[model samples]
Target: MFFCLLSFYGGNGYAENDLQRDNPLEQYRQLFAEQQKEFEKQRRIIEEQGKEIEILKARINSLAAQSPSSQPPATEANNDQTVIAATSPKKKIEIPSKPVGQAPPQASEKPRPPEIPRLSETVGGVLTRKGNLVIEPALEYAYTDNNRVFLDAFTFLPAIAVGLIDLREIKRHSFIGSLAARYGITDRLEFEFRAPYVYRSDSQRSRAVSIGVGEDEIFNASGNDIGDLEFATRYQLNSGSGGWPIFVGNMVATVPTGTSPFEVDFVQSTPGAVFPTELPTGSGYFSFQPSITALYPSDPGVFFGNLSYSYNAETNENVGKVDPGDAVGLSFGMGFALNARSSFSLGYSHKHVFESEINGQTVNGSELDIGQLLIGYSFRFTPKTNINLSLGIGTTEDAQDIKLNLRLPMTFDFLSQAY
Candidate 1:
């Protein structure tokens, strides 16, 4: 039994010794061979992708060469995918065959400044373009009412009169039609001539001091004739820039061509009351006026103003030598463009007249103050024609109660082809 047991133990020890002698190098070699196979598979896949990239680059080069214009050959680095992407063709732009409301490229080389709508002839908002002519026909209507008090007896005490008192009221209506022509001598200067026809009608009411009639007496008179002619010249002083206003200088001359008030005969309608047989058509005095106008443009609006002085020449009449009063005038306004074709303006005008002289003697109560508020509107019918309407409301007793004027201006460009 002991020999059997020893043999069993010795057999087990020999098996353990054989297991310890086995080498790990053979297992490591087998694992390395499997990893090498995987490396070769990955290398083959990378080579296939490179060939595909070359094929795409060749296609891109062929397409670029087929274009209408040829470009210089790219460098080696430019053939890369990133560089090629940067050089891709841009989308073509399509232009319209006939462009609307756009000036030709050659004509737009020096673009003109924006033009503001014209308000009135006196204000001189914008000058006529060079080599152009403007013809304007205008119609105007005015109405006036006057009240007067006369004392036949001398005053005995302050605030007390011991004489017959007379009261009178007069209403008048006037109409005028005028044709004017303006020519542009240059871009900055213009000349204008105007001729007008005038018609007037008047009604008078009087209460006599000694007459027995209780109702007011009425008198009516009317006259129609050619009126004074006018000539004007305007020159621009400066170009508006750097937040500066544009200035224009103007001079106007008038010629008396109509009937004078002294030429008309007056007849006494009642005691202490007299009325003219016919009304006068004009002032019957030559006059000259020099003025300066200024305009400033802001966003969406324009401001304008003018100052003037009028000198009336003395004239000889049957009554005596008469010197009409000199007048100082001023006006200011603002205009807003409602749209591309329409605009509106609001303004105020004032004039102060000095005392008149008759035979070197100052006429009592001959000084006058005239004030009016003006509202104007303009509409453009075409590029060469427009209509302007203005209304005036009197703010002083000397001024007309209401006045309305309408004008149509048409322009002709004789030298447009030359330009």
Candidate 2:
């Protein structure tokens, strides 16, 4: 027994150790053993698969490789195969759609527009603001039959246009064509200039034998022309007076551009009798007018007022020496807005003339004075267009005349121009 056991152990040991001892071929022997074991395992798997496939093929061939029929068993097998295939790793996931009311973001490729604000208007065209230019034209007819005014009948068809530069320094320029212009002469003061044209015509009949003229002869004068030039200035005094009021000294000048042309004759004078005389026309000599004005602004700014007094010094060669020396005038005014579309103004002006020279004679100046009432209103047709109306009633020592006016103002942006 012992010998038999020893023989068994020795034989195994020799079989294993001998291969290892032959070092020249040891690595190759191990590789061959591993390859042989893999081949045997693959062969066993193939044999099992062959058995199953043969069974399935035998059944299929028995069924004559026929098209799918209304057979219960065949249908079951087909369904099972479909389910297995659907669960495979290669399948894609379905994406859900967005909600019905939701919208996707716009593409990154589109362009956007810049934002710009525009100017608006108010009614009667009384007040309109946009660019720096404004033009106003008015056609008016007036009739009066009193001797206290300049005309029994008159017409003033006038148009004004203006442009302002550096008006209020907010870079907010102010301009009303032919009527109003406020511009900067320096940083602390501004200048305003206006010249309104006036035209007048009238025919009158007078009673004879009153002063020295005959009944058959009457005074008749008919013609029209431009009014005067007005220049004014405003100076900022002491940082706006701290709410008490700011005081500004002003100087204004008016060049009388509209004067009546007339011819006179005594009623009892002979038919061939004549008189020599020189008439003033177009524009009167320059008159230096000075005044002091105060502006009072309110908190939250609803009520504001302006008060002023002025003097006009006569410089005419014909009248300065004989009949008139100078004139004194006073103006008191208050302005209040009724709403965004409306405003109200009340003012009074009184002027006195000094006796001076005429025809080289120290003649007492025949009294001539002026009284005024200012009324203005505006209407808006749209945000960009408007119509405005204003009427002024004037009473002179010699006569009382009535005047009416209207204007339409439209604003347009230069950068957004249309062809």
Candidate 3:
């Protein structure tokens, strides 16, 4: 009876173990069904979110189309889209087709006004954009005439006085051609270099009472040489909008690379006649100029002004110790846009020079004042090319009588991808 009981108990335990093994497999199947249900729910949620995004994008595009300035012009927008499509790999969205003979969407009830093209802000003497290079070739012509009188002292008896008068006339003509290159290091900083070639002709006529001369003795001299080399830098201090004016600071240095008048040999062709072998192309000493420029924009026109001070370093040469006078300058101008491709400008400039020192002594009658009236015009040939013309008329005795200038400016870009 004990053995029969043991066998029955063992069979019952085996039956329980088999039932537990089937329950694990059934639990795995149930877990897998629950995971599939969760994944399906997430996928449906994602599809709904994608539809919402598409609807939002369509609404934003519709609103942009209604605003003239909010979106680019039709042609530009098409071109931009074409560029994006060509540069990117993206899946195209398909639209559902109507069953048969579906009607097209209705036109917008309110039509958007046509957008006017924005005017180009480029002007003469303006700084270029960052990472851009500008090359300007210019030619200038100037003419001036001066008259001088010299008095010779004579021995006087009692109250009677006798003196000799010398009258002199001098006429000068100059032509300068320059090539300037400017580069923008940043949005607010720029550097420039300029090299100029100078050609000059001088005519002098003098009459002296001591020397018997008929129709005064006339002498002519001419010289052609390179002028001073200049390096300049400019920084935009602040960019102003509305009623404020833009401010720019500038620094310029000039090297004494040209022929100096003091270095030229003096020739005496006849008695009481003295003349220089050649005309000077530049100042003999180094100079530095610092200036501040301001510009105020008012739609189709711009008003500009500049204030500057220049300092010249003294030099000791074969002639003697010489120091060129320091100068202060002021200028004000207005530029007007005539059309999309042309502009005009009118301006005035004034300069005052202090007395010069020679051999540690102040030179008498060395002070000078000069003033000029300027007019300029610019025409754009292409997006990157311009032609500028200018005229300057002297308004003071020490200034040149007239000056004419022509300039051609071209722009280029390098390493554009780095910007």
Candidate 4:
């Protein structure tokens, strides 16, 4: 009986031991499963965070490509923080630190300089700015001396033609004072008007042969009167830079408001000797001149040129059918800016006039070629005033020997004050 009890107790002890081992094993399995679930959740969050970081990096690269130099530092930081918060839900993310001594992001490039008016502005006859007014009072003087030889007989038959030679010398002086007003209608357009008064004096000395007898005569004439009225407009076609050239188109019209030479009566002092009663102050024809001007600006200087054509309307007077010749003109020059307020220029001007028609026939000696060398100087008196002086030297016989001109230009801002 004793032996049987011992055996049963040992079996009970073995069962309790096995049950205790099973309970500990079950607890360990549950804890391991919980740990695996937590690991998986963390891995998924890390993957999402990685994907968000990649997206943020792409956006940052895109912004840098668009304007690398213009973006602010604060803007980039805010964007980075926003991405981190959306991706890292359970853990805090550390922002990357910038390198020491790193420079802040820069702004865009500097702006261009303002357009300022310079002495070269008027050298091409173009307006500088809108709402600007320029008043110019000017004076011009010219002197000319001419000699003519007249033969009464034909040149082919020298033996049949008697020695009839006449020599005439004429000296003339002219002075003009004018007031011109220019107003800018827009930045590229300008209007101009000019009125002039003229004074003239002429002296003629002639030696004539009549029937082989020579006689000398002298006459003098002087006149003072108003000259023609002129109106002009200038429009700038382009603004130039670097190697490009600025172009301007101009149209000028003249009115026959002064005394016409043809209207004056001729007094016969002696046979074959006729003198004008009064001197003429104008061409007595309505005319229009169309021109184009070009200016190319280089460093410290500018080059300019102009081409023009003038058309004069026909007129009827006491001298019968009169059609004045059309004329074409060309000028070229270079201007040097001596300083901020002064400039000098040298140029050449040429004009070719077509033959004039009288009574439907072309007149001999009516076509003229005129050329001149021009020198000009300009000085700014004040911010609103400038003085210009010019000299013209004749290069052709028909041109005046010398001419002097002075102009004073003053500016005012009428519209600005009104506004």
Q: Which candidate number maximizes TM-score?
A: 1
Cα RMSD for candidates in order: 17.2, 24.6, 16.4, 17.4
Tens digits of lDDT, candidate 3, 269-311: 5454578888899888999999887777776888877888999
TM-score, model 1 to reference: 0.73
Q: Compute the lDDT of residue 325 as modeled in candidate 2.
A: 42
Model 1 poorest 10 in a row by lDDT: 91-100
lDDT scores of the candidates, listed in order? 0.81, 0.44, 0.76, 0.77
lDDT of 1 by residue, 1-419 (tens): 99999999999999876765575676678789999999999999889767765765665555444432443244432454444353343532221222324455574322122344444557734677778899999999999998988777678787777656778898999999999999888888889999999999998888975546688989899999999889999988877767788888999999988888878999986766778999988788999999998888776787889899999999999879999999999999888889988888889999999999999999889999999998888888898998888889999989999999988889999779576
Candidate 2: stretches off by over 4 Å: 1-144, 148-181, 184-188, 210-219, 236-241, 256-283, 298-325, 359-362, 378-388, 394-401, 405-419
Q: What digit string (tens of lDDT, one per residue) describes model 2 on residues 297-411?
A: 4421222223333334334352233223466665555444555554444554455655545655655445557565646555556765556565557666332355455555554
- Residues 14-75 of candidate 4 have per-residue lDDT tens digits of 99888878789877887899999999999998898788789877755554544435544766
All candidates in order of lDDT, best leading: 1, 4, 3, 2
Q: Give the C-alpha lDDT of model 2.
A: 0.44
Top-lDDT structure, candidate number? 1
Better of 1 and 2 by lDDT: 1
Question: lDDT of candidate 4 vs native?
Answer: 0.77
